[model samples]
Target chain A: MSMVSLTVNSRPLRADVEPRTNLADFLRDSHDLTGTHLGCEHGVCGACTVIVDGEPVRSCITYAVACENAQVTTIEGLNDDEVAGELRAAFTREHGLQCGYCTPGMIVSARDVVLRMPDASEHEIRVAMSGNLCRCTGYVGIVRAIRSVIVERKARGAAPRADLRTALGPVGSGHAGAFAGGADKTADAPPARIASPVSRAATPRETAKLDADFVPQTSFPQSFVVAHPVDVVWDFFGRVDEVAACLPGASLVGTPTPEHVEGQIRVKVGPMVAEFQGVADISRDDARHAGRISGSGRDTRSNSATRGLIGYTLTPVEDGRATRVDVSIGYTLTGMLAQFGRSGLVQDIAGRLVSAFVQNLEARLGQGEGAPAAPVVTELNAGSLVYSVIVSRLKELWRKIAG
Target chain B: MKPVRFDYERPVEIGAALALMQDEGRVVKIIAGGQSLGPMLNMRLVQPELLVDITAIPALKRIEDTGSDLIVGACVTHADFEDRRVPDVTAGALAGVARGIAYRAVRNRGTVGGSLTHADPSADWISILSAVGARVILRSASGVREVAVEDYMLGALAADLNPGELLEAVRIPKCSASARWGYFKSCRKTGEFAHAIGAVLVDPDRGVFRAVMGATETRPILVIDRAALFGASGFSTGAAEEVAQAAGMGDLLDRRTHAVALRRAFEQADAA
Candidate 1:
């Protein structure tokens, strides 16, 4: 049980209620504010809607303990509120309600729509009403009622109230960034950053966006110097069978086709290691001496996703046997790979990978006669790539922190 | 049905809330908006011994506008966001998504932190914010940590939040001029959960292009900048199905539904 105090319907109310008691039950059982009804008792039906600190909230879903030291308004409070009173009259005049089960929530929601969305369109009204399901009435009359309220409010030249509670004072203000004492491990750090609202333009496209499940596709460019002639290096990478072998943490599964190779690439970052089955569609343009390997795969166990568009162009150097290989890689990675795919970390790892591959290539090409020696660098494994890079990044960040 | 008997605590500050949740050594659940938890409570899906109400904590409700990132408090309601009372760097995309959550009543109480912490893969915040590269600030007894929104959800109703860790705020980057986005959600009708969700965000300047599919009832699957580099016309009907099958959706119906949703999303992005 919890001792709770809150201002309800312009009166101070105190109660010893169960911690899980919802605001709707608290209002109805203790204060007899049955006007704030309950329907589904979950969140779907808005029958138990009430204004907590001027915002319409589903009392059925809101806990009574959470409302301590706050202002609450039930349907009974509408008798005194000018905007709600006007809305009640409009609802009655337009037959906006049916069996009245959803009326309380509808009316509370209507007050919010009228007060906050002063210039709501018909579509906006429908959207606002969508959250509060009214099974009895088809919502045609409800829309009409809210629309009338909008028009009336607009004609009167009324601005929306900036504060949640018109009767009570505001609830809280900003605080010091740090906690009261140096009690926990976080005490050594600076205080939390302060949050103050910043004005934004009406156009949405120009502002900040927060979206879900939007894994962005990104491309990175890598350039490395190879210690061999452009033609020699180009020919070396031109062969499909040899080119696929250079990939880190890779093993070809079957006989290679002219344009296809099936393999698995393992990503091991310390304790986290994931193996993804990948199929690369190998292609090369003889005229341009450029290669493009477009491939995608997923690790079923980790539920991680990987897609890569790797294209390389070998340009001749001004002098000597050195050739500059420009690698432009575009990839979309989700789940595990994405977890470590920070830009700085990725770039550093990629640079090291190219360095390792080029060193291996230089070793194999050093053989003047017979087949090239098996140029295997054990640390070049993808697991080591992900692990070493992540560890180094963490160490670098830790260094900056210590500094 | 009412929830089983539980103790409750409402702390006015973040530190107090953290200490209570951590040091109390009892089964505690943090309730921000209560919109989602309320439904689960009635169905008896979960009942903790203590409910730590973080709504009154002033810090969690603050909206700080840094020059580049918009720091939104965890308790900022969808209604507050929908009404444009907070800073949105994603243009009006945040408000637009907020206005459509469940209902005006639900939005009024449902919060960004609660939504993200709840971690529904099909949730607009999970897909949209993750696509836009938002990070969630988590406060715990140890300290504060920031996690990319895209990497937060592990599976349905699963998140990376550790015990004693509470989601504090969300940091979103301001939309740049080159950013173009499209989101398509197919719900049975209004207010119902989505059947299939496709969200794409393209920013040529930052080299970010992603197409994400949600509402699969698990984790979201994404296709990177290829969607933007290739353009919408690049996807034939066969290509869309291939991309869906590649993501490894569990069932045939899901593959088809996700494919149609992704195509619609690409078409919308192209039109935009």
Candidate 2:
């Protein structure tokens, strides 16, 4: 058994819950905050929608322990909300409900729709509230009711957001809390909030983000470019320290040996940054003006391992007036940064870093890093042009970089 | 419906979560969004003895932009994508896909990682991501492997997820600004699970053209080559027929319905 504390409907509550206790069961079976109905139990039915951290999420699947210290606002809390009060009236006036089984879910969803789409059209309203299903009323009445309220609110210039609750006075007080047009609101209620999962049926973490002996790493290809002439660039590349200085939010510091270059590079993935120290075996072929740099290292901070193989070719362009530097880097990232591999974000950032490094290189090359020529805002609807620009940019930046 | 008894742990880090999964005897299921598993628990379709909740692990929620792709953690919720919380590198097609999944509440809770990991063929991300040639990351105590969406999904409600391995994230390659994308789904009604899901992604310059037809049955039919998806007729009835025949989808769906959906997808991508 574990203890959990949360602010539910402006009420601070504490309870001992089972390890398997879900928020829906905790609320309904314990404190009896049954206003947040549950239809499908899965997330499909909007019946379990409740405001958690000001965002409406399905409570049916939310673990009770996960809500520790969270602020939970259920339908029961909307009694004092003026917008909800007004909407309840509109729902009744429009005959928006028939069986009333789906009323709470509808109202909760309607609240979110109004807050998000203040000037929503009829079609938009239908789409926004489509998650909540009502077998009765065919949803036409519900749609009409929500729309009328939106229109009425617009006329009054009343903000769609729920403001500080003003009292509705007594329109006939009831045994239940929800102001769903004088209904017992808790008829289908099964969830009652208990102090914890310590009741007769009651039964239910570490600080690490991952718990693997060795998290898997993904290896992918990434690229970058340089504007300097090939011979000049290759000469510049020979100077490891200068090249390392080019990367923004990154720096590689070390001495170069005849056979290899050893350096430590510090890079910030997000708030968590790591410094990778390694030795690279450099293979340079001046005859072909091509080279391969391979290295292996470990992040001093996270102890994550990293390996990279970068192959480059220097091609003369514009009749040797310019040098085209093409790079193909296949890197394997493991441990702390492996998760970032799935989204392909780390690689994208790697692309951005190269761009930043290129500008930095321009500065190092005695060429002032001018604000890159005004971006060519290719007009929309030109797919062919877009493709060309992207292709050119890849040649200019890195292969398969930005769109 | 309340879930039966089960042990639960909310691991703050991935290492701890993986270690917990390695324990023997108890059946373990990874619960990130709980949007898919929760309902199944209530309906008693699945009742695992233990649930490893990874939502609170901050690292799992991070979004990083790879040069060629925009990779988001598996825990990113649908609303995050819909609201552009992360860098939308899919030319608004990714956001559009997130927006039309279930509804606002589900979007707030249902995660993209979970959607793909669960591998519901009728689900939006499965068909759409597959159409766009996205990749999924699978990690376990053993190691990590990246599987293209096309190869990852085996059939309806089935994914190539190994036991004790969790889906890490999905890598959606950056689409060109003008790359046309069209995704169309036919449902019995609003909010209903899709019946016929068609997606078209075309970037003529890169020679990337893909067409996918989903929700017929066990697996979604796909056409990734440029010629197969965009024949001489350009996704017309005849083109769709050829694609359907090539993809073995003609027997799965009404040829007319398949043709109509294919045409809509092609036209939308062209128009957009």
Candidate 3:
């Protein structure tokens, strides 16, 4: 019903499209760009891969309306690029594909890997291509094809590939930072200064060296500081029943105590109920002017080892009108629980647990009689900022490395 | 594979887009990146009466990063995030999940606000934004209202956004130097819908931590609390199960295949 003009693979074309018309559909249906296929119509399969403005994405899941004035490239567009040619040759020479159903996506995804990761390893190649599924080739040939390109490129004295290792550094690493100039103005700012000088350098070689020197072997402490007076906060945190009651799905399985208490707690997650028996260790730090509490327990029903520790430090600020609390925790997992673990899933569940605990603590502290009325300031330190930047960068680098 | 016969409108501004939506009502569906919605239409899954294309709206395409937060327009695509042209928080989060969203071409056309509004539990934005405590700004003829990511998603493909309301932008709180954040997803293959997604943001100094899990259900499951509890013995089975149960996340096996993933996330946060 409407006329729209857009560019595809550097060519401007006009089309009459419905509002619901997807760009991928337009290309395949109207423009005859069949190189981009459709699989998992819900946006999971990489069969419909394309390059728009130098980044690769799933064309199948993208709408034509969203790309009114954007540049787009299908597999057809790669006909002229040397990197694409090399990848094609490598795939053929290495037998990188089998059915070829996923070839277009494989090649497009590999193109990104090669461009971003000039110095990738075999392991890195596998990780990068992990996103694109090839049911037939068993990934052996695909990995070899990509690795061959990197090896050949390196042999020619080309720049090192942007492997996941280098991408894991701080925001300003040599390779990752190269693209920093292209980042939006907001993301271009320098990272906050942390107390420690943790190097944010890119490159697996550099990361390996840094890890060797500072592995962060020391576990997170079980004590922390709250922004309120130690005695006042202690009176609230010391009660086991109150702590259990404050938790969303926590139910005390035993008695309360002043110094230490042991209890069993049941948490219902979906259809399963996981229970843990834990003991709290409470103490005071006079030198640093803080209070601490540590709890350790395991899921007896699931027969999994799950441990937790909490520490708090309270600092009076603004003429005692408000208090600042520094809390730290260290947890561990072992036994049956260790087998099913992956990076992202663990982070999500852990993040939710922590958030719930904080909200509960805040609500409790806010409700108590005669509680101080002050803004609770949550500050991120320099060390943490550096870690976030490095972790984020590394994740990107990993994708390129895997591809 | 092309879309069925339907009307199309490309409004130069938001007002024109809104007027078209008002006239067409339920018959119209707005398109941004078309990353998710595009494929559905191609497959004939959704047939709308009218198509109100907003890609030409210049204001909706800008990504603004204020010191305290990052404001992403509705038309910002996944390609934009992959290009590192957005804030680190936005780019990093998108990059982590981009590889799994199909292929390079889809990313180029996918928009952040579009994904969030679509409210697909398996979609990347649902979990990432919820985990990061991002807010969605909804615009309607009546006015505008801001809803937290955690509250906006009511269920799978179900959101609090009304039919006439448009998702204008997403606001992500600026991360601090000391905050520790991580995002993870589990799927059968790369560029696949997540069987489970976990996102964590921890501020150790302030004793605050937020953990969100999406794709396990219709909406993202959020938990906000003190980070220290993760280190306690109670964290693994006690607090973990409690938090999971409260959020109606179901059983470990049903929601996520592995128990180790749950434990690892807890351990990582405890260490942070």
Best by DockQ: 1
Please provide, for model 2 over A19-104, each residue's C-alpha lDDT reduced to its tens digit, 9 standing for 90 to 100: 45778777887889887787876676677778776667777777776566677788889998876887899889888888777788
Q: Order of all candidates by TM-score, from best down to worst?
A: 1, 2, 3
CAPRI grade of model 2:
incorrect
Candidate 1 structure quality by residue, lDDT tens digits, A1-403: 4466778988989886766778888899987889988898878777888987767788887777666666788888888788888888888999888798888888888888888778899998887777788887788889998999899889988778667532111121111122122111233432222111121112121211212333338777887778888888888886565655565565666677868777666543322345666677768887787887777766644456677778898887869578898998776777634644544344444555675576567677776434766656534433233333335434543343233
Worst 10 residues of 1 chain A by lDDT: A167-176
TM-scores of the models, in the order given: 0.63, 0.63, 0.58
Please give the range of 10 consecutive residues that has the lowest summed lDDT in model 1 chain B.
B224-233
lDDT of 1 by residue, B205-225 (tens): 878777777776655666564
Error of 3 at B170 (Å): 1.4
- Cα deviation at A302, candidate 2, in Å, is 45
The per-model DockQ list reads 0.13, 0.10, 0.09
TM-score of candidate 1 on Cα atoms, chains taken together: 0.63
Residue A324 displacement in candidate 1 (angstroms): 49
Q: For this target, which candidate reaches the highest lDDT against the unseen true structure? A: 1
